[model samples]
Target: RTYAGLPVLGGDLIVHESASGASRSVDKATDADIEVTDTSAAIAPSGAERSALSAAQAAGDRKTGAEDAPRKVIWAATGKPVLAYETVVTGVRKDGTPSKLHVITDADSGRKLYEFQAVQNGTGTGQHNGKVTVGSVRSGSQWLLKDSARGGHRTYNLKHSWDETKKGSAFYDADNVWGNGKPTIAQTAAVDAHYGAAMTWDYYKKVLGRNGIKGNGKAAYSRVHFGDAYENAFWDDDCFCMTYGDGAGNKKPLTSLDVAGHEMSHGLTSATANLEYSGESGGLNEATSDIFGTAVEFYAKNAKDPGDYLIGEKIDINGDGTPLRYMDKPSKDGLSYDYWKSGVGNDDPHFTSGIANHFFYLLSEGS
Candidate 1:
């Protein structure tokens, strides 16, 4: 609508006299127009699916048309119980992010309430005590690396394949135990990836008060061992998953805790401001990832992977003990700028991001 106003419902009948026809008559709704027959409250949001379906069946499929549980409500005008159901219709949002809707219905009459969809922020939350634990399930006799608690955030084995489109199989084990203190085995890296994801999810939920990466109660899956010694980790919007490469010679998997947090923050940024990945906004984009990544690492004080402001310290992308980017002194990388200059935006985002990274560091920690 152009603007919000009083919505007029079903008032079409109007007649004008032939002689001196100025404004003759209009048909208005009376008490009988909205009289409720069954004003009962028997069905709940769960069981109200039948009523929700009956209400929304005209728009979409009879069974699946009810996007959410029906909501019960009384006609405000009549001050009577006229339960109506408002279900979320099918459609992706403008930014292409998924939409969610909930519904409730009257208990007795089974009348559905009004349907609606809204962008609810921080709807879901996670709990991580900074411990090395995996949320998994038993299948037949094996335990799969799946986090049932945090929206089923799972880690898969790409088998050193480069196909990002394919979601590799789960890292299953006969015993629930995983890893042996090395990245040689597939499950070893899977644990790192899965655990890192859990920590990041927890950081966002507990510290930042976000539901998930998208703030939509959904988890982005992780793909480990994406390529042969690929030496890279990336978050793809298309796949909506984190892909980690086995570092040079397949010795190191780029599944560090801070790195996971950093990657997921990109999705967060996309869902929010959607800052363009170019110019000053691009640098801010990269800096946002680093900031939240470091925050997540700090929030998650796991002894194995302790918190630190240094980004990507465990992955060793530089072939030395040094991390990828330093927030305190980005110039240490030899390519990043310590401060923003007139032409800083022309440089690479990772390099130009040093300015913001340095600022966040100084602001958070002290000069």
Candidate 2:
């Protein structure tokens, strides 16, 4: 039972019923001397909503279009129980990804306490895992580049604009065969991305006995050509989408098969273990993605981009004709650690991930 929205547990007391129909006294798990000083809210609901919106906007660097009214609740997750407000703010981030931020605030002080984004991230199209079949939808005698077989997973062209509020146009073709195997054509990158998503979906389903990234048998979408000369791709948990950017000089797209697997694996990690993206946990998180990405590539058996232990080998992000990181000998990249050591958490996750990456390589292929 709650008192003034604060859980007081049977009005500061709980009666236990014995199997014999006898009543007994049990500890209520709260201090007996604790007093309910303020049963009413000091700040209005509007003030709480504003507090949440302000914090969401500041963190996302964009204006929130809508927000749910604050609801009075008990904030007893930690410390003394206190009256608090929970608000949800919705907006589009600066990177053209949708955001649904849940914010909690102190009821009396209206101070923001907690907030989390709700979108997803991933890989490139300028470089892909070679030729592969993709699911498409037919409408009005035209083939739309959509994965109807895989929960209607679709790809959109962002046109280098960060406006996720409005989805860009879907790629279409008469022949139903997409892409010319070159990044010069926009459809080329889209084809690669779509194919990669399909392959990743299949890898998880067929090999791991998992249904989808979230294990709910639902498909997540992808967005390509995100920004002008954008050099990276990412997943947004709020939007439940993966976005890719055209690489340097707009010549390379990062949508390789392993890249797709790598980015999408981040989603799986979020859904499962939810490792904190910092320090040792963060390194493990990144290494998990790399390990599964390599698994997906091998599972794909794509001839053009043969499966290898090298991550981002096709994208060539380094421009020196070297893959982003190596698993067999992680230190080959001169940044990632090849073995576990003390204080490895002090390094960035990408660098710290090398330790586990090397370990996986050894475990799979042997030293």
Candidate 3:
């Protein structure tokens, strides 16, 4: 993945090996190009991000919040790899989804080479699971939102901030009572996030026999109340955590059980297959999360939020009580496709994902 001591993109793969090491095959990131280039920026780095952002905006890519310093990399998406700068910008999208935009600029020519979204916005649940229990630990007198049994997993509060430097504060309670199932209280969202994380964790470990999101027995963190009036939840592999935004006036938190499972499963996909987040592969990436998320919901079997084939039913993201996505018939959203067409990959991954979502429903529950 390196050429002249710089990282090279589009040169990775996912190998599937049987447990006995008898069967093997390449499963992901197979579009590698045999190209190499030296590492040297021909132009000044001051205007790289500005240029990229300008182009992104002109193309209707909006709501950019944080921009990362440009980093030199060997771009292999082209037949010939050349020194390029990759910049990642984080913000909330117009659909209330958290966004991570990657802008690749040719270092020598100062030409924008490529761009893609890294954030995975997904639908999922539970202002709607009734009162639930979350694992907590006490450090002296104050009870923490951390759960040690589950790989010492912890939850934090972003307080509507998207600052990358800050990891956010931990939720502390004197009596360890946590939230009261109300959205106004700050602890309320934290409870949902913490419980959601716990449920997702238990589902993978107990049902799937996986240790954690990364399968290394370590847990990913969660942050709640991210951004002002934010109405979505997202998973950014760069952050190694799941973030939930308060929906519609900072009152409707998107930290449902299924939502947690969906976002966290994104981490799992990134860790394992890491399917490119565009075209048909991108759509499959999202559907994989949806499949596992629904599995987690069923595994929980919580009486308040019973398992169902519906996605985002509890969040009311559409202003009505309609679920964000329908697995049985994706066209119910009026935007998704029930089956593949010639140019389905051209659609947003969220919409194109309906194809796989529908297939999974039929495969799992059957027509």
Between candidates 2 and 3, the lDDT winner: 3
What order do you get sorting by lDDT, best first?
3, 2, 1
Instruction: List, residue by residue over 93-196, the lDDT tens digit for candidate 1.
Output: 34322333434344565544445443221111111212256667666567777775577788889999987789998777777777765765777777777877
User: What's model 1's lDDT at 223?
Assistant: 94
Question: Going through the candidates in order, what is the number of backbone clashes in each?
Answer: 20, 17, 3
Using lDDT, give the best candidate's number: 3
Q: Quote the lDDT for 206 in model 3.
A: 68
| Regions of candidate 3 where Cα sits further than 4 Å from its true position | 1-126
Q: Write model 2 residue lDDT over 127-215, tens digit each, in one string.
A: 46555566675665787777754556899999888675546778877777667678778887897788788888978976898988988
What's the lDDT for candidate 2?
Answer: 0.79
lDDT of every predicted structure (CA atoms): 0.70, 0.79, 0.79
Model 3, residue 58: C-alpha shift (Å) = 68
Residue 188's C-alpha lDDT in candidate 3?
Answer: 83
Error of 1 at 22 (Å): 81
Residue range 326-361, candidate 3, lDDT tens digits: 999999889998999999999899999899999999
